[model samples]
Structures are given as C-alpha cells and as structure tokens.
Target: MASNTFERFDLESSQEWKPYIARFRQYMISQKCDQTLYTAHLITAVSNRVYKLMCTLCHPNKPENTEFEALVEIVANHFGPKGSVVAARYEFRKREQRLDENITGFIHQLQLLAQRCEFDDKLEENLRDQLAAGVASDAIRQSLFMEKNLNFTRAKEIALNMEAAANTCKIGKENTIDNKAKINTSSTKSARRSSSRCWRCGRIHDEEPDDCPYLQFKCNICTEKGHLAKMCPQSASKLTPYNTRKREGYVKKRYHTRFSNYFGSDSDSGSEQSEVQVIVRKKNKKRQLRYVKK
Candidate 1:
C-alpha cells in the first residue's frame, strides 16, 4: 500500500506544480470556495474542501438538510488519495458549473432554505431576493414605480433609506438625495411662478392684471386712437385767453369807463371810426332837441 501511494504521488510530482497550483486556485476562487489555498502544499491539504460540496449535492442518504459546512465535508471526501490536485480541480470545476446553474433554479424553488430565513414585508423581501439573484436596484425600483402611487424616485428614496438604516440605524444622515430632490421641487415652483406676464407691458413678472394689454384695448393716446384724452380733437381746438382776444366776438372793456368813453386808448384805428359814428349820432340828437324847443 505504501509503494502504491508513493508511486501515485510521484506521478503527480511529475506535473508542473506551480501552474497546477495557479490553475487550482483560479478554480476554487471561481467556484466561490470559502477557504483559499495559497501553495501547492496547501492545495493537497484543502483539496477535500471542494470534493465535499460535490458529495452533498450528489448523495441522497442523510441529505435531510445541508449547510455550507456539510457541503464542504462532501467535497473533502471526494479529494481522496488516488486523485492529484490538478486532476481534482478539473473535476471540481465540472461539478461547480452544474451547481452554479442549480443555484439559480434553487433560489426560485421556494423549498430549500426559504422558510428558515426571516423575511421583511413584501417590498423589502422582493428587493432582497432580486439583489441576491444579481438584479440591479434601479431595475427593481423602476418596476415598482410603475405600480399605482409608487413613483420611481420615491421608491429609490425608500430603498436607500432602508439600506442606510440596516447598515447603521443612522436616519437623515443619507438625506443628500432628498436635498437634491428639494432643489428640483423648488426649481419647478420658481418656473411656475415666473410664467405670469405683466398687464401693461407684455413682459414676464409675478402677476398680471385681469385686463392685460393683449386681452384689453390699448390706450388711445399711445396707440393714436379717436378718444384718448391726450389725442382728442375737441381739446386741440379749445382756445386759451390769449386766442379768445384775437377773435371777432371779443369786446375789450375800458379801464374804468363805459361805451360813452369812446376815444379809449385800448381801441385800434378801426375802433376809433366806430367812436366817431357814436359822436355824430349824439350831435344829430342835439339838433332835433333844439328844433323842438323852437
């Protein structure tokens, strides 16, 4: 038995040890083995860890329930004295590949380890399951957002808050996301407020009159209309005191005299002619009076 064991080991020793060790390490890491093998010596020691997982998956007896440790034991049982680390790695990869596919199916099975774990409410539980299955947070949140009243942004906020709480019960510390959202809301409100246009000037402002220039008639003066006070034809023709004196109907009053004070300094040359006629009428009246007395 000792001769056979030595011969079997010698065969493995003939293979390039460093490359074999490197290849085996890659296999283990890719397979997601818990314990790492640093050297070829350690590979032989830790080789059983891989075979143990395979045994647990393949075996039916005593397979009531198996944790990571039970799987490790099964992997160790397979890495027996007859197999070399290099040969064992190839076989390990084959088994792990099948297990990887089954892992996806098993997660959805709802029978293996579902009831053992405590679940959050439906929302959180579904999110957790999706993340475990490598689904993105944004994708899940977007899907939830399609539901009634579940906006994407709001759902993301809830998820981020929940994660922050789970990490370290520190509420409101991760509120930077909320602060940006507030800035957006304020910006929208400002945009809405700025939409009002002024009544008099068609310019954007905080408020507009009910009778804005665009809606109501324009001022006649500014728009050159018939009835604006500044542009009224009646006002243009209305005379001032100076213009009234220049008109034909104006009769100038003497300083402190009546019509008998005909030779007034205020009269022009034509006014003097009217005074002479008045004197002639008085003379004619005197003649008539004298004849009556005779």
Candidate 2:
C-alpha cells in the first residue's frame, strides 16, 4: 500500500476531532497496522504545535508510552467537552433542508446529525418523521402525510422523485417562456420590417411609401413608367387583399320589372326606393329598359 492514507489533523476544518480520529482508526485498520503502533502513528499524524500540546498533555509520561485508547481520550478531552444529549437531539430535530441544498445532500446531513442523537432502535422512525416534517418542498411533505405506513425508505424515495420531477417541470417551464419570448421578438422584427416595406416595389427601407426607391421604376408587365410589375393595375395575376379596394360610388335607384327579370321602372318588389344608382345608355331616347345579367 502507498504510505499516505489519512490527512493530518486540521482544527480549522469543518470535521470535528471525534470524527477525524474515527476515520484515522478506519484508515489504520485498512492498512492492517499493528494495534501497538496506533499511538505512535497518531502522534506523527498531528502538526508540530499539536504534537507539543500532546506531549504537554502526557506530562511525565511520553505519548508513545501510553495506550491508544488513553491517548485518544486525553486528546479528545483537551480538544472539548462532550456535547449534551438534549442539545444534539434539538439540533438534529431543528435541521431542515437548506434552500441551496439538494435532496441527497439534505438526507446525508440528516444522517450525520442523527449519529449524535440516541434514538437507538427508533432511529429510522425519527429520521422518517423528521425528513417528512422538515422537507423543503411542500408537495413532498404533503405526499408523505397522505402516504400509508410511510417508512424511511419509502419517504426518502417519494421525496427524491417529487423533488426531481418538480425541478424538471420548473426547467421546462422556464425554457418554454424563453422560447415564447424569442418568437415574440422575431415577430416584432418581422412586423417592423413589414411596416418599413414599400408596397409599390416590395423594397424594405426606412422611408414613406410615396418616397419609395421605385418612384420612377417601370412595370415589366403593363409597361407603366412610374410603378413596378407587382403594383401594375393592369396585371391580371395581381389579385391580393392589398389590391382589393372599396368603391365609394353610389348605384342608381330604379325599379326592375317582375315580368321576366327585365329592368323597367316599376315592380311589386317594394314601393320605397333604395339609394341605388345605375348608368343608363340612350337608344331611342324613350327610356328603354336595359336588361343586364351579372
């Protein structure tokens, strides 16, 4: 095995002395180190200042001369007193999932906190209740509430699934909103282009329609000198909504003969005349009825 297994003791690190020492023992076990040399290894693992402090703690007796358990106890006492049982449990119970923490991290944090709490055989039960009670998501919490005979495994599974699904949905919704905003922006650009587009020649520029670049452009189809082929009134293939215009002329009011759809001057269709006008041609100058079919 390689020489370096465990890192040196770090008081400034987030890991407490107890957990650090526990991990050091596991490392020693993995290395198949002799139990008698554990105290010696522990002595070298600490920093210079820590080794001096340990020597002082040993007093007349040398650190290497002591038992492993005794040296550990001495070091632990020097570091800090054991925490209260009530305080540890209170801290464990109060721990809720933080806003930036994910489900896996939150559950791991709970497990760490539960170590100090002496729930014994009811550890799983306490964990389950605490997880359900203090979950960050209300949907997960409520699902746990409605769940029948919810255990730690079941509760954790449900909470994780719910959290994952909610996150995916939130991402999808944000992406959808972004896509809609982009489409709206594209449509706005298109509208601006159309607004500045010239109807006479289909050229786009920031100018009025009458001041278009094609003011003197000739029409290819109609041979018009002042308009393009698309804007030529004589073009038969130019039927479009823009080409259709409302006529403001009035139709001549006249009576149609009901004899055989002939245009005379009287009819039983109605007595009151509508505001209709029609152009008539003079033939014999006696007002001859001209029958026109639409």
Candidate 3:
C-alpha cells in the first residue's frame, strides 16, 4: 500500500538519533550481528559507491530504500551506461585500511539514511536535520565512525515483522497432504504390475519366491520353503561332521554329580570312603591290585 515505505527514518531532532539507534541496536542483537558480524571497509566503500550510483539513477524525491527494479536500473546505468563504479571504489579503497574507521562511519551513515527512508514515516527528517546542523558530520562522513549509529534495531524489527508474515503465509506440512506417489484409481493395477517387475533379472514377476527365475542356488542349504538351513537343528554341524538328528539319542554333558542328590543318613558319611579297584596279572603269575578314588 505504501510505495514510500522507506521514508520514516528521517528525524528533525538530534534527540531522535538515540531512540533510532536504540531500535537499530535491538535489530542487530536480534540478527545476531550485534558484535560478531564485521566487514572490512573495502566492501563497505564499494557498496556505498554502488548505492550512491543507484540513488543518482533513481533520482528519488527523497531518500528511500529503492526496490529491486530501481536498483537494477541504477546498476545498469552505472556499468552499462555511465561507467563502472565498482572498479573505482575497489581501486580507491584498496589503499585504505581494511578496517578504516572513516569507511565504517560512511557505511553507518548510509545505512541510517536508508533506514530513515525505508519505512513510511518522516524518520529521515531528523537525520537530515542533524546532517545539516553539522553535528558529528565528520564522523558520519567517516565510513567507520558512521557504524556507531546503524539502524540495525529498526532493521531487526522489520525482519521480525517479515518473519511473522512468512509464518502466517506458510501452509504447514502437518496439515497438507503430499500429492507425490498418490494413486489414481484407474492406474492402480498398471502401477502395481510395473513395480513388481524384477529389476535384476529384467523379468516381470508378481512376487519374490524361491522358485523365481532369479533364484541363485539349487542346494538344499538354499531351500527355505519348508525349512531354513541355519534354523534346522537336525542339520550336520560343520564343527563335528555328525548329523544333529543322529546325535539326538546321545546324552549331553551333565554338570550335576550322581551323588549330589543323595545325602548321607548320618555323620558316618564323612568317615565312609568310596573306592575303585583294578587288578593286573602277568604271565609269570605276578598279580597286582590297585585301589583308587578313595
């Protein structure tokens, strides 16, 4: 609704700078660039030059944050018609300090001016008045010093507004149904038939089965229709070579003692000694008897 949305930053009083700056600081804080974000004066100088060129092309009745098309016109006028300002700014700023305070001040002033005009109000009037009064004019002219009065606070406020607008405009994914992969009743059968085709064998099949032409091995080990080899407890063990089915009758090793459940009747059990005996007889009629396990 407002073509001149950027005109609100100009203020008629120097006192307005404080509130303006406060708002800008708030914006910078919100953007998370309050202290962390820093740029060399070279880039600032170039941007300043480009912005000036753009302003000249627009010839706006007053300071304003020009639209994209206006900016394009300015850039075209600079490079395509008038001359290349980028090269000049680059050449000039290269000799200056990268963090030149003068450059920073100029950058800040331009931003303040832009901010002053970015909204649909007379905020720029105050800024223009301060400029005309020559108060801190040198600082404002200095690209580095101008940074002190940035309009980040207002910009951040504007950003927040834009973010809120975006949120309102958003169609949340939770509520929206994804149309991708949606099936049409007419094509259901065809889609399914096409998808069932075996990609590896290039064979069109309705299913994945052991008898499928794409089947790999013919060994019983590979047959899992009635039983899987790994799951077949009766299968021969590679470690023993004995079929587990055949070894079913064999007793597994038992850890319990045969006499463990048979407790002695009295203290006589302690004195009682169990023994095993063996006898050896030689051809010379010599006999030997050995008793063990006492």
Candidate 4:
C-alpha cells in the first residue's frame, strides 16, 4: 500500500498505536494483502520522524528486514501508554447514566471502562452489577435488582426496552419531561383588601368609594392619582409605623384613630369623614391618617 493510502504515524500527535494498527490489519484483510506486504506496509505508511527512529532501533539490520509482528510489538511496547488497573476500575464503578445521555450511551461508556479495567472472567458480572446500581432511573434499577438470574445482556435489554417505552409515552403526552416549581400566587391573589386601608381615600372605607370624602384622591405615599396614601404600593412593601408600631403595642400607643363613618347620618357625617386630622410625633414615626367614605 502507498504511504499516503494510510494515516501516517506521528509520535508528536495524539494518534494511538493500537487503533492505528487495528485499522491497518482490517484494511489488509479486506484487500487480501499478503503477510509479506504487512511489514512493508507499516514501514511505508509511517512519517519520516518515525521511520528515522525505527532505523536507529534496527541498527545494523534494516527495518524492512524486521519481521512484521516483531516490528509491531517493538513499536507498541516503546510508545503505547500503560494504564492503571485500579484507576480504570474506579472510573468503571463511578460511571452513572448522565441526565442527557441514554442507556445505550451509558452502557457504551461502561464497556470502554471495562476494557481498561481487565475484569477478565468476571467482566459480565461486573457490567451487570454496575448497570443495576448506576442506572439513572430508580424504576429501571429496582426492576434489574428484582430480576432473577440477571446477566449483563438481560440488564441491557431491560434498560433499552424501558427507555424506549418511557420516551414513547413522553412523546405522546406533549413535550414536557419534568415538573417545575411555581409560586402559590392563587392563595395570595384571592386574598381580599382589608377594610383598614381605602383605595380612594387613605382611611378605612365603611362601604363604597364614591362616598369617600376625598373624591379627587391623590396618594401622598406614591404621589399617584386616583388612590389614597393608605393604598400606595410603596406604603405596602415595607412596615409602616402605622401598623408596625401602633397595632403592635395596642395598649401603650397613645395614637388614636377615628373612622370617617364614626359620625351618624347627622349633618356632621360628611363633614366628619372629610375632616383632615394632623398627628404630632417624631419625624421618623410620622403616619398619615386615612378617611373612610361610603
């Protein structure tokens, strides 16, 4: 075979000897290339750097004269990386199905780890145990654990079938895969506005807003139109001295509030609710009075 026909081996690159030689062997078998050609094929396919190194290694005898099997064995022994058995086994044991990965992909990863681990006669048993213990789905793991005489092949079969069935069911039931968290907004939204704070005027309204003493309502809290200082959003977010301090110490607070509806249907009714009362207190503890209308 021509040198360019196969990938050139460069010691500087990440190219691995095992896979490179495996591919060459496969091509040779398919082409029915003679065993005699294998030695020449390997020598011809390597880069100049590798070839020069091989020449030095062969010394008095040329590399071409070197037996193909001996040449391959010599090069592999020189450059092929040695793997740690314990490390490989640790990785194999730690291998679990990833969130986005399927059972097949997970199993393929396990198989790769198994090759490096050298489980030998117990390879199947080890694979079976890892598959059962490390499957992503609790149902699949439980099923495998409960199965009688579960082998590697049987575990793989069960996992694939379960995965396919789950995917099919999900596809048929819209695209949603898992539940997401949400706020309990219904409980909060359904709550009614208390009679203490009026929307039109600032005070607690006994009934309708149209009867509010301050019909041209403007909130002092938010400086907004159509709402009272008591109904301001800015007023609602933080604890006001009104409710926080006054209501907290119901007995000690010298502050007193009178409702707009405190007066009867007598002539003082409209004048009474619309009465603007002033409170004298510390600037920090200051609170605006709210009037309730019809």
Please report the candidate that would top lDDT against the real structure.
2
In model 3, where is the ten-residue run with the lowest total lDDT?
36-45
Relative to the true structure, how large is the alpha-carbon lDDT of every model?
0.40, 0.77, 0.39, 0.75
Candidate 2: regions farther than 4 A off: 1-79, 197-216, 219-294
User: If both were scored by TM-score, which would come out higher, candidate 1 or candidate 4?
Assistant: 4
Residue pairs with colliding backbones in model 2 are: 251-276, 251-277, 252-276, 252-277, 252-278, 253-276, 253-277
lDDT of 1 by residue, 1-294 (tens): 011111112122444433444555465566555552222223244335333444355567432244534443453445432335455433322332123333234234332233323332453454333333332335434544454665324544555554455446334546866888999998887787578645354456544444343444444544633233443455445422231122343333212112332545655544323311111123233311111100
Output the better candidate (2/4) by lDDT. Answer: 2
Better of 1 and 3 by TM-score: 1
lDDT by residue for model 2 (1-294), tens: 425546888656566778888999899889988888888888888778777888899999988898999988998988877688799999999999999999899999999999878889999999999998788888899899999988999998999999999999999999999999999998887788667757778677765677777888878997877668876777634322222223444222344322332333554354332322233333432333344432
Give the range of the ten consecutive residues with the poorest summed lDDT in model 2: 238-247
Model 2, CA-based lDDT: 0.77
* Residue 242, model 1, lDDT: 31
lDDT (Cα, tens digit) per residue for candidate 4, span 1-294: 333487778889899988899998887887778889898988878888998888877778778999988888778867865679999999999999999999999999999889989889999999999999889999999899899998999999999999999999888666443221123453333343333456676666554567677777677877777777766777656432332234332322222334455645643654543433334345465655543343
Q: What is residue 37's positional error in candidate 3, in angstroms?
A: 38
TM-scores for all candidates: the values are: 0.18, 0.49, 0.16, 0.49
